[model samples]
Target: MEKCRASSRIVIIGAGVSGIAAATRLLQNNFHNVQILEAENRIGGRINTVYFGDNVIDLGAQWCHGKQQNCVYDMVKDMGILHETGDYYSPIKRVRSNKEVIPHELATKIHDIAVKSMPSGPHPVVGSFGTHLAQAYWRRIESELPELDRTVASESLNTFAKHESSIIGADNLFEVSVREHIEYHECDGDKLLHWGTKGYRRFLRLLMHVSEDSPEELGLLEGRVQLAKKVTKIELACPRKVILRCEDGDYFEADHVICTVSLGVLQEQHEKLFTPPLPAAKVNAIRGLTLGTVNKLYLEYGKQPLPDGWVGFFCLWLEQDLTELRKTEHSWVEGITGVHMITCQPRMLMAWVNGPHGRHMENLSDEKVLEGLQWLFRKFLTFEIPPPQRFVRSKWFSNPNFRGSWSHRPTKADERKTGPWDLESPVLGEDGHLGLLFAGEASSRNYFSTVHGALEAGYREADRLIGHYTSCSAKA
Candidate 1:
């Protein structure tokens, strides 16, 4: 039985966390004939980390999110690699585009009230989170805040909306389903766990069972992953086998195939990639689920602009300023919700942008982006800031392999009546064997858009295959 399981060939598409997790679990279960085909030249898909200036910066997935019940946290919690990032709202500055500095105490109070106003559980009524939040927030503001502070509080809420949009990977909260937003299960413990200088790539090493102190190496996946193998076609109609044809003209046959491509890729390539076409339900789910863009701009300064112990700047734009900016070339600047100082790198700052504005930012030249940032800083801050010595920006929306950042449950998801379950279901071959399976963060119902969710999805598929073979062998 063990030998039979070892001989069963398996091919996994994408070398992201999900794919790597699936491969690792399979190899551990004695499935020796496993291969991972990554379209990019690198192993980690969206978990890219690069050295900038004096320290490493993650261009992709940065934090561990939560500790309790998080598989990624469980693996590295005691390794001394995880760093607890205290309250994200503390030691911060909130300034309006009109050059009005909000008091820290008042800003914190408004922020707390705004957060409390948001729905914490699934609403019995079906509606958009934006609508519900707006109504609730304004109601609280009318009763709780003084009339003089209401305008600033309203602007602050707008800033909070942008930040929430970036986190949910939505252009606006109105596009997100209120019920689905609340359905997402957040793991208990610290919500922001940083890897410090190690970067997210360290998670990959630990998955391969490689020690941090040892020489950097891909322990189990040394020769198993083929980079730059973009699979353009998948022939699943074959009697008892599954065949994958790559753009490089290389092909492979496997007893079973696990696809861990991002939701964005699936939405773009599902029709051309599959042989007999994906089920209508799966296709509908793909269309219904939204993949929104979240981009980052990294700026390295010759001199630090912010004081020590300062978290970052939250840009609250007055309605008049925002309206005027929307009429000019600097409209994309509105997408930038906040500019945060890198945790360990004192001279570096990171700006976050989301939605259509993120896509627009990708099309602009670096010089233009810098100009916009300079204009934004000047409008909001009282101090004069120097130009960045070096600049780096992420273009996840423009990348063909990844059309956008992450998935979200859209407002129309309920109407479509299709979801992650439809995507996760396997297609059976003529011989009644599982020929094609799906695994990715998007397929995780409760934990979509999370790295740990991706890992869990991978383990789920691998266990399914293991259980299938085990049952079959018992009957034999």
Candidate 2:
């Protein structure tokens, strides 16, 4: 029985966190015949860390998010590599598009009021989170502030909404399901835990059980992954084996196949990727869940350093200014709600954009993007900021491998009664055995759109196969 388990061929699609975690767990359980097929030339699907300026900066997954109940945090808590970040909202200056500085106290008050009015937990009523937030926010704004401050507060709330949209990977809160938003379980503890210069790729090393100081690879995973293997089809009609055909004219047969591709890729390729097509329920689940875009623009300042004690800029644009900008090509700059200094990289500033604007930014030329950034800075900042020495940006939306950033539960998801559970269901072969399995962050019920969620999902699928083999061994 042990020999049979060890000899069973297993193939995992994508070399992302979920795929890596699945392979790691399988190897630990004596499943030696495992291979990870990655479409890209490199590993770490969405956890991309690159060297920028003087130190390392994360282009993909940046923070650990929380410490409690977070597997990534628990694994590295004792390593002395993680640090708690300061309050993300406070100690920052708020500047309007007209170059007027909002009083710190007033900004804090508006932020507090807005946050307090948001739904804290799931409600019996079903609706869009955006609708609930806007209605509740306006009521508090009307009762708390004078007419003079009302206009600025309302504009500031728009900036806040943009920030929320980026966080949830949605174009706007109105598209997100209110029930799912409240149902998301946030791990209790520090909300933003920084990895410093080490970067999020450190978590991948931990999964492989590799030491940071060593230049060695784990024996189980060494040569186990095949890069640039874009799998185009999964033939599951075979009664005894599952066949995978890659775009490079290569093929592999496996007793079991686990797919860890992103929800975006699944949405784009699922129709033609599977043989005999996926189950109708699974297809419905894929259509119901949405993959949103959240992109980052990094500006490197080599000669001119940022102002002292500088944290970030929270931008507030008046209705008239926004209306005027919409006429110009730089209108996409309005999508940028804020820009902040990278905690570890002192010479770098990160700007965030999401939804339609994020996708638009991807299509523009580098010169155009830089010019837009200059225009944005000139309007909001009091100081004379020069163009960056170098600029780097993420193009997740334009990347063929990843159609968007991550997954989010949209309002349609509730109406359709479909979600991660349906997507994660295994497909049975003609022999009445599990042939195809799924694992990814989108498959996580409570931890969707997080690195920890991806890790957990991978472990879940690996454990499923392990349990099945264990049951068979016991029967023997």
Candidate 3:
């Protein structure tokens, strides 16, 4: 048996924030024998950005999340990627019956009341987030509230339900929504938002800073991250070494291995992937939670700074029976309810779409996708909407590696209910020796789905491996 050396090599799967963090921490801690194995030819996982002329668009993670206690923010600052104030939640652009854009101020006021005035304390009746948020709107909106049966579906409740689904990536609207948690937890919606690259990539690079999103960028960053390394199997049976098999007929043996692949990959391809097999509990947790996608439609309107600055999401509202949208697929989509447009400088606007509705919209062909937009465009304001001079889209869900967007609030049954083991991914054998170990965002808790979450988890796993070895050496 090959004795694990203090410099025993470590292999990290995935080049996202988590994997990069783990490798960097190990190297910084004097562990030089480490290499990152990324299936995609890029790093940073979901924190991907695209360069179009002067416009810097983010196809993956666009937000920096909480600023108050956000660790990634500090890292960004450390990396000198300064951030300015943002207007993400505000200017709540909404499309109305007239096909004209509704000022965000109106919804902001209503949302404020609803959020601040939510009911408190435990309840005998346990309802889904949709039910809770709908009720919250009723209490806060008060007179502004729409008709409601209370006994059944209410207008305000249904709208809230749809809004929640659109925000969260839930399979259905009325089922359960991640938006409730965001609204319930986040006191202030205003936080750091998109600013070209805004040091977002720089910050991540400083942390994990391994590979770039695209093949070209990888060359730009130098070949620190190994690309096109499709991980076929992970063997952790021999406690001191984890062997990683690549599809390209290559192999890597590491003292510890971190599996930072998304839950989507785990859930979708777990049966054939694991060598020693993942815990039954962990497997169940992954599948129970749903993975979603967010596709963007960037429209460059011929340098025309029209009135109201491109009307900022100026599009028509769909008239589907909100209830039907809540269903997975009720025959077909009824009609456009609303359109969100953001008119910005350099002539560019993005249409933010997520959840089931976003999925339906993104799956369509480029021509069809544009047609859907034109349907809303024509219904709202008539203009010579040209076949976009530039088009941008994301294949996050379709990609086998990514499967979909980042993690969401796992289902009640899916949520991890216990200690930190779920957070401490292992790649070694059961004999207390090291074969391999894995950790990353999907392996993290509390901070999962965020860059910091991925960072902390990566560090934790590295520390675990290093600490265990340190103790064993001390005894010797």
Clashes within 3 Å, all models in order: 0, 0, 24
| Cα lDDT tens digits for candidate 1, 96-170 | 887787888888888888888887774544788899889989888888875746678779889988888999999
lDDT of 2 by residue, 1-476 (tens): 22367889999999999999999999999898999999999889999988887877788898887988898888888989988986876777788988887888888988888887777674735888888888888998888865637678778888888888888999999999887788788998787898887888777887888888778754358889999999999989666578999999999999899999999999999999998699998999899999999999999987435588668888999889899999999989988988887787777888998899899999999999999999989888888888898999999988888899989899999999988898889988887778899999999998899999999999999999999889878888
lDDT of 3 by residue, 1-476 (tens): 44333467778888887787777777767676778888987677887866753456677776666666566665654543454446543453444434545446655555465455333444413445655665566664556544423322233234444444545555444444333243223323335544444335655645544344543443322445798898988877554567778999898887777788887888787778877777775665665555666556666656643345444442222345334334633212222333444323356656656665565665667777666665555544635555566667776777888887765553353244422244354534777665555565655555555666678788887787678667767777
Between candidates 1 and 3, which one is better according to TM-score? 1
Off by over 4 Å in 3: 1-6, 78-80, 97-105, 117-126, 143-167, 172-190, 195-199, 208-224, 304-306, 309-311, 314-345, 382-386, 412-428, 434-436
Clashing residue pairs for model 2: none
TM-score of candidate 3 against the unseen true structure: 0.82
State the weakest 10-residue window (summed lDDT) of model 2.
116-125
- lDDT (Cα, 0-100) at 375 in candidate 2: 91
Error of 3 at 12 (Å): 0.3
Q: Which 10 consecutive residues of model 1 have the lowest summed lDDT?
A: 119-128
